[model samples]
Target chain A: MTTYKRMVLASRPQGHVVPENFRLEEVPVPDLKDGELLVRNHYLSLDPYMRMRMEDVKSYAAPQAIGETMIGGTVGEVVASKNPKFAVGDKVQGMFGWSEMGVSDGSLLRRLDTTHIPLSAYLGSVGMPGMTAWYGLTQIIQPKEGETIVVSAASGAVGSVVGQLAKLRGCRAVGIAGGKEKCDYVVNELGFDACIDYKAGNLKEELAKATPNGIDGVFENVGGEIFDACLERMNPFGRIALCGMIAGYDGDPSPIRNARFFLTMRLSMRGFIVSEHMDLWPQGLKELGTLVATGKLKFRESVAQGLEAAPEAFIGMLKGRNFGKQLVKLI
Target chain B: MTTYKRMVLASRPQGHVVPENFRLEEVPVPDLKDGELLVRNHYLSLDPYMRMRMEDVKSYAAPQAIGETMIGGTVGEVVASKNPKFAVGDKVQGMFGWSEMGVSDGSLLRRLDTTHIPLSAYLGSVGMPGMTAWYGLTQIIQPKEGETIVVSAASGAVGSVVGQLAKLRGCRAVGIAGGKEKCDYVVNELGFDACIDYKAGNLKEELAKATPNGIDGVFENVGGEIFDACLERMNPFGRIALCGMIAGYDGDPSPIRNARFFLTMRLSMRGFIVSEHMDLWPQGLKELGTLVATGKLKFRESVAQGLEAAPEAFIGMLKGRNFGKQLVKLI
Candidate 1:
C-alpha cells in the first residue's frame, strides 16, 4: 500500500514506439497533504493522442516532458482523503497518468457513481472517448435522418460510440475496421449497417460498395489510405469530423491523395480535441452514460495487466493490434 | 455581322492543355424567339475553373462537352430584343460561353449599370470571381480583425479580391504568387501586407517570414507545394477556404503532406464553389459592387485581343503567365 509501480517516458520514439521508450519504476506513493486526496488507480486509458504529446513539437498542448509520468486518463477509488468534500470510498475519474496510485487535490477529480455504469466505463464509453465521439458526430458531422455515415477505427473507443450515436439519430451507419473479426463484431454486435475490412486489400471497392449512396458524414479516426478511400466516395457537401490520425502517430503523416475531392465535393472538415469543448461534455456524457447503462451501446476493451505493460499495449494499439479500447488494468 | 466567332472544346487534354484542345468556329447567329434577346459579347472571362470542366471527370458540375461552346461568363450589350425586359444598347451579364454573340431568354441575363463601374469590371471585381473571393473569405475563412490571412495566386481574379477584401476587414493579408511582378502587384497594388514569390525556390522560408504570427486564415486558390507551405505555418484553429486547385487542373491533385497539423492545430477547412450558395450572392455582390464603385477595391486585367486568342490566353493563365484577371475582349 505504501509503494506502487508507474511508467515514465524514457525517450521520444524515432518512428515507431518500442518498449525502450518507456521506463517502469517502483516508487513510494505520496502521503496526502491538507485538502488533498489519494487515489488508488484501477484502470489507465491508452489513447492515440498520448503519442502526439510524446513528440517534442508544437501541438495543441505542451509535449509530455521527458522522464515524466506518461499522461493518461485513470478511473479509480479514493484510498485516502483529507478534503471534506471527498469520501475515502468514493470512485472517481482523473488524469492521473500511467500509475498505480496518484495524489490529487480534488480539483481535477470527478466522483463516479458506479451503480449503473462500471468504473472502467469512465475510461471508455462515458469518459473522454465517449465525449469525443459525441462532440464530433453531433457538432461537426450533424448527420440527418437516412444519411449514411462512415466511422473509421470502428472498434476503437471513440469510433465505437460515433457509429452508435449516428444510428441513434436514424442515420445509416457503416464502419471501417482492420480485420474480419472486428468488422463482424461491428456489424453483428454494434448494429452497424455494413462494415468494411480494410486489411482485406479491397478497401476502395468494399468501401464504395458499403457506401453506395456515398458518405454524408465521416467520423475519421485512422487517417491514411483508409481516409483517402473514404474521401473518394464522399457525397457532395459531406462533413468530416477528423478526430484522430493513428496512422500518423509515428511522426510522419500520411498524405491525403484525394485532396481534389475536398474542393469538388465542397466538403467541410474540422479537427477538434474533446477537452477544448468542455461546455458540451455534460450533455454528451449524460447521453453516452444512458446508452451504456441501458445496454443499447456496447463497447469492448482489451486490458493489459499491470503498469509495466502500458508501453507495449499503446504501441500495439497504434499498429491496430488491439481489438478494441486499449486499457492498462492496475490492481 | 450575321456570322459570329466562337471557341468550342475540341478535345480533352491529357495532362496539359494545348491550343489544339480548343477550336474556333464561325457560325450564323440564330434569330431571337419571343421573350429572347441577342447579346453582342464584349468581354469573356477566362478562369482556372474552366480547366476543371475540360476534363470528363466527376466534379461539382458536368464536364465541358466536346464541340460545344466552352462555358464562361461574359459582359455584353443587348444588340436586339424581343423580351420587354431587355432593350438595345443595354449592358448585361450572362453565362454566354466563349462566343462573340449569344441569345438569352432574359431568364439568365442580368442588367448592368456602367455609371461608376465599367462593363469589364463586371467580369472581374464585381463578377463571379469577386463573389467567390467574398464567400470564401467571409463565410469560410471568417478572418477576425487582427488575424493573418494568406491568399494564393494573389494576382488572379479570385485571389486579388480575396486579399483586398481581407485588408478591408482589418486583417493582415499575406499573398503567395509565382513571379516578382505578381508578388509586387499583390503587395503594392492590391495592398497585401506581404507577398511571397513561390518561384523564388524558398517558398517555405519566405512564407514563414511573411507570416511571422502564423497564418490564421488561408484563401487557397493554387493547391500544390504553395498550399503545403501555408499549412505548415497555420496557427491554432486556422481556417482554410479551399476555393480552387489550379495546379490539379491536369487531373492529378497534389497530396497534402502536413495532414497532422489539421488535428494538432484543431483547424477547420471547407472546400466550396461560390455558385452553389446562391442565397448569399446578393448581399455579397452589393458589398463588392460598392467597394469597386467607390474605388475602395482596385483590379487588373490580362486581356487577350479577340475570340481566336482565348485558347492560348487560357493556356498561359494556367501557367501563371496572366498577371491578373485573364480575359478575352471580343469587340
Candidate 2:
C-alpha cells in the first residue's frame, strides 16, 4: 500500500498564522474507484488568499474549516486511473490542497499540456494569477494608449503580469514593488515605464514624479496606505480594479484616507475575485496562455521544496519576502 | 438700466459658512448684448456642491473666486431678449448665481414651461437632484426586480426620488434618514419597504434587521459612519452608487471603518457627477419628468425667502436642518 503526507488545519488563525495552526498527518493512498483517478501532486500553489481562508469570517470564498485539508490549487500527474478521460501519467490541475496525492473523479481535473511552458507555470502565469491580471485589466481598468497605469505589488505574480500587460497595450506602466532589487527587476526585465520602491518611504513623491500626467487606471493588489497614495495621484475619471487587500488580510487595516477623492475625481472602483467571473475565463486564458507559451509574457517564481514548506511560503508572501510568485514544489 | 442685489464671496469659509464670508452688494445690471437675454431672478437653487466650489482646493469645477458672483443655478423670467431663442415673459433656467438679475448669452439658458409640473419642481425633482437620482440608480446600481436597495437621505430630493423610482421598478426600497419624521415620510409617504433612523445609533443592528436578504444596491448620499455601517451590511456582489458624501463636505468625516468589506464582498462602487453623463440626461429626464407630472414621483423643498436668507439657509442645509432640497426665493 502506498502512503503520503498531508497538512490539515488544526485550528483557525486568530491574529497571525503560525505553522502549529496546521497539523501534518500521514495517511495511506486510497484505491481508485471506477471513473476515479489518483493524482500525485508535484506542485502546490501558495497565495496570500490562503490567509483569508484561515479565518472563520465571511469572504469571497468559504472559510477553511478546522480539521479539514487546507484548500489550495495544485498541479500533478495522474499516477493511476480507472477513467477514460484521465489516463495514468497525464498532467492535470485541480484543487488538490496541501497533499502529496489526491483522488479525483475527473470532474474537477483539467488536463494540461506542458509542451510550450513549464509545468509550474500552469499554477503561476498561465493559471489563476495570469487570468486575474488579464480580466482586471481588460474589463475594469481598460487603460488607453498614452494613458498611465499604476500597479501595486509590482514584483509579485499578478501585479508583474498586470504592469507588463499594461505596457503591451501601449500605455505607460508604473509599478510599486517592496524592495530596490525587485523594483529594478520590474523596470529592467518587465519593461515597465517606471518602478517605485514602496519601502523607500517616499511613495507619494515617487509616484507623483513617475506619473506626471496623473494615473488614469490602477490595478490595485496591495491595499492599505499604498492604495491610499495611489488614490491621491489619480486623474479625473480614473478606474481602480481592486483585486486583493493583502495588507488587511491579517488584521483591520487603517481607513483609506483618500477615498473622498472617489467623488471629486469621478472614480470607479470594483473589487473582484477571478473565480466568480467564470464567463471571462476562457477568453482570458486563451490570451494569457499564448503570451506565456510564446515567451512574450514573462514571470518569475520563488519555489519552496515540499508541501511542508507551504505554510512558511504563504506567510512569507504576505510579508513581501517572496520576490515573485511563491509556490511549493513537491517532487 | 436696472439695479440688482448680489452676494459676492468676501472671504473663504473657515469652518462654517457665515454671512460675513458673503458681502451683500447692489450693482447696476449691464445691458443685454447680441445673443444675450436679461433674466429677472425668480428662484435661486442652493446645493451642497456650491460649498465645494467656494473652497480654493481643486474640485470637479473651478472654485468660486473671491469678489466674483457665487455660482449657482437659478430659475427666472426673461425680462428682455436680443436672442430669438428667448422672449420677454418666458420662464428660463441657467447658472445665474445669487443675483436679482442676470444677463445670459443664451447658450446656457433652457426655456421652461410649468403647465404640467410646478416651476420649482424643475429645479428639485426634474432638475439636478432628480437627474442625479435617476442616473445613479439606473446606470450604476441597476437593482434587479426583487433585489433590495438602500438609499441614504431618503426624505431629501435625490433620495426621495431614488426610493420611489426603485419601487416603481419592482425592487424593495429601504431608506436611512435623520429623524423619526423623515423616516416615517420615507416609509409611509414614499412607499419604501422600510426606513431606519440613523440618529437612533443602532445602524448596524437596524440595517441588518431592515435588509433581511442583504443589501444588493445602495444610493449613497451620506458618507462617513453611515456609509461604513451600510458597507458592513452589504451582500456579496453588491453595488454602491456613491452620489454624495455630505458628511465630508465641511471637514474630515470619520474614515470608512469597513472598506475591507469591498474585497470580501466583491462590491462595485462608482462616484459620478450627473453633468458628466449628458448622454443619459435625455432618457433620465424623460422618465423623471413624466413621473413628477403624473404625481407618481413626490418631492419636497424648503424655500428660504429672499436672497438675504441664502447664507443661513445654506448653513442650515449642511446641518440637515432643512427637510428636503433647500432653495432661495429671490423675486
Candidate 3:
C-alpha cells in the first residue's frame, strides 16, 4: 500500500471558508478491488460550486461531510486497472476528490483520449465548465443574433465560454468582471462587445452604456448586486439562465427584493444544475473542441502547484483572486 | 344633438379613488362624423384596470388626462350610425367611457350579438376580463393536470374565471378573497378546490393548508402580504401570471420583494397587458362561451342601478366590498 496526502473538510463553514475549515492529512492509499482502477491525480479543478458543497445545508449536490475528503473533479492517469475499459497509463477525468491518489469503481470517471487534446484541457476548457456555458446559452437562454447578452463573472470559467459563444453567434456580448485586468481580458482577448468592471461604482451607468437597447439575455453566474443592476436594464421578453449565485454562496444570503422588476420586463429566469443537462455534454464538447482547435475559443487557467495547495486555490477562487479557471496541478 | 352627463377626472387620487376626485359635467352629445356611430350606454364595466388609467404616471396603457372623461368599457345600443357596419338599435360593447351617450368611430367598438349570449356577458365572462384569465392561465402559467394552482382576488372578475378554467383543466384551484362570504362563493359557487379569506389571521398557515402540495401556478391579482404568502408556498418551477398588484396599487409604489424566493424556486413570473392578445380573442371567446353555455363555467355580476352609482360600485370593488364582477347599468 502507498501513502498519499488528502485534504478533508475539517468543519462546516458559517460564512467564509478559511484554511482551518480544511485539514491536510497523510492517509493510506485506498485498495483497488475487482472492476476498480487506481488513479494518480494529475490536476484538480477548483470551482465556485465547491463552496456550496462545503456547507452542511441541502443543495443540488450532497454536502461534503466533516472528516471526509473534499469532493472535486480531477484529471488523473490510471496506474493500475482491473477494468477492461481503462488500461494502465490511460488518462481519465472524474469526481476523484482533492487527493494525490484514489481508487475508483469506474462509476463517475470518463476515459479521456489525450491524442485529441491535452489531458489538462479535459478538466478546464473542454470539460464541465465549457459544457455548462454551452447548454446554458443554447438551451436555456437561446440568444438570437444582434441581441445584447450579459454574463456576470465573465472572466471566469463558465462566463468566459458564454461570452465567446455569444459573440460567435453574432450577438453583442457584454461581460461583468471584478477588475480592469479581467475586464480587458474579456473585452479585448475574448472579443466581447463590452466589459463592465462591477467593482467600479457606476455599474448601472456602465451597463446602460454597454447595452443601449437593453440586455436580451443574461447568463447569471454571480448574483446579488450584479443581478439587481442587470434587472434594471433588461429588455422586454429577456431571458436569464441562472447558472450560479457565487456572490451569495460564501456571504450571508442577501434578500433579493426585485420581483416587480422581473415582472414588468416579462423576463424568464431559470436556475439549473449542470448535471441536469448531461445528455447534451458530448455535443457541447464536440463544438467547444472544434472552437478551441480553430483558435475561435480561448481559455486561461490559474494553476496552483501540488495537491496541498487545493484548499488555498479554492479559497482564492471564492475571494476572486484567480483570473480564469482555477486549477491545481497535482502531479 | 343631445346633452349627456359624463364623469371626468377632476383630480388624480393620492390613494384610493374617491367621489371628490371625479367631476360630473353635462356635455353636448358629439355628432356622428362619417364612419361613426352614436352609442347610447347601457352597462358600464367597473374593472380594476380603470384605476391604473387614473394615474398620471406611465404604465402599459396611457394615463387618463386631468380633465378628460374617465375611460371604461361599456355595453351600449347604436342610436345612430353613419358607419355602414353598424345600424340603429344594434347592441354593442365599446370603449364608451363613463357617460350616458357617445359617438364612436366604429374603430373601438365591437358589435355585441345577444343571440349567442347575454350582452353584459360580453363585458364580463367572454370579454376582456374573461380573455385575460384565459391567456394568463393557458399561455403564461400553463398548469398541467393535477397541479395545484392558487389565485388571489379569487372572487373578483379575473380571478373567478381563472379558478374555473383551472378546474376545467383538472387542476386543484385555491383562491384568496376578502371575507368568508366571498371565500364561500369562490369554493362553492365558482368551484375552487379551496379558498382562503385574507381577513382571517395567519395567512401563511392558511395558504399552506389550502395548498398542501405547494403552488405550481399563481394568478396574482392582489400583491401584498398575500403575494408574500404565495411566494413561500411556491413549488419548484412554479409560474406566476401577474395580472395586477391590487394590494399595492392604492397604498404604495414600492414593489413587493419576492426575488430571492423566485430564484430559489426557479419561478417564471410574467406580466402581460390583455390588449396585446386581441388577435386570439375570437378563439378565446368561442371556447369560454361554450363553457358558460354548457354550465362548465359560471359568472356573477354585482350590478349598480345607474351611472351615478358607478363611482360607489368602483370604490366598493376597490375596498373588497363587491362579491363578484361589478358593473353599472345606465339603461
Query: Which is the leading candidate under lDDT?
Result: 1
| Tens-digit lDDT track of model 3 for A143-261 | 99999999999998899999999999999999999999999999889999999998888999999999998889999888788888888888877888887777777855643445445
Which tens-of-lDDT digit does each residue in A1-331 have in candidate 1? Answer: 7798889999998988889999988899787789999999999999999999999988999999988899999999999999988999999999999999999999999999999999999999899999999999999999999999999999889888999999999999999998999999999999999999999999999988898899999999988999999999999999999999988887667888789999999999999999999999989999999999999999999999988889889989988999878999998
Residue A243 accuracy (lDDT) in model 2: 89
Count of backbone clashes, every candidate in sequence: 0, 0, 0
For each candidate in the order shown, give its overall lDDT on alpha carbons: 0.93, 0.89, 0.85
TM-score of 3: 0.90
Tell me the docking grade of candidate 1.
high
Model 2, runs deviating above 4 Å: none
- Tens-place lDDT per residue, model 3, B1-331, is 4788888889989887888888888998877789988999998898887787787753556788888888998998999999999999999888878999888888888887787588888888888899999999999999899999999989988999999999999999999998899999999999999999989887888898988888999999877778878988888788889888776566464345544455456676777777787888888989998887777888888999887888888888888888778888888
- Candidate 1 chain A lowest-lDDT run of ten: A248-257
Lowest-lDDT window of 10 residues in candidate 2 chain A? A250-259
Q: For residues A12-98, could you state the per-residue lDDT of candidate 2 as single tens digits?
A: 777777788898889999988899999999999988788888887777778998898899999999999999998889999999899
Q: Name model 1 segments beyond 4 Å from true.
A: none
Candidate 3: residue A132 Cα off by (Å): 2.2
lDDT of 1 by residue, B25-88 (tens): 9999998899999999999999999999999888999999999999999999999999999999
Candidate 3 — which pairs collide?
A: none
Using TM-score as the measure, the top candidate is 1
Per TM-score, what order, best first? 1, 2, 3
Model 1 complex DockQ against the native? 0.89
Worst 10 residues of 3 chain A by lDDT: A254-263
Q: For each candidate, what's the DockQ?
A: 0.89, 0.71, 0.36
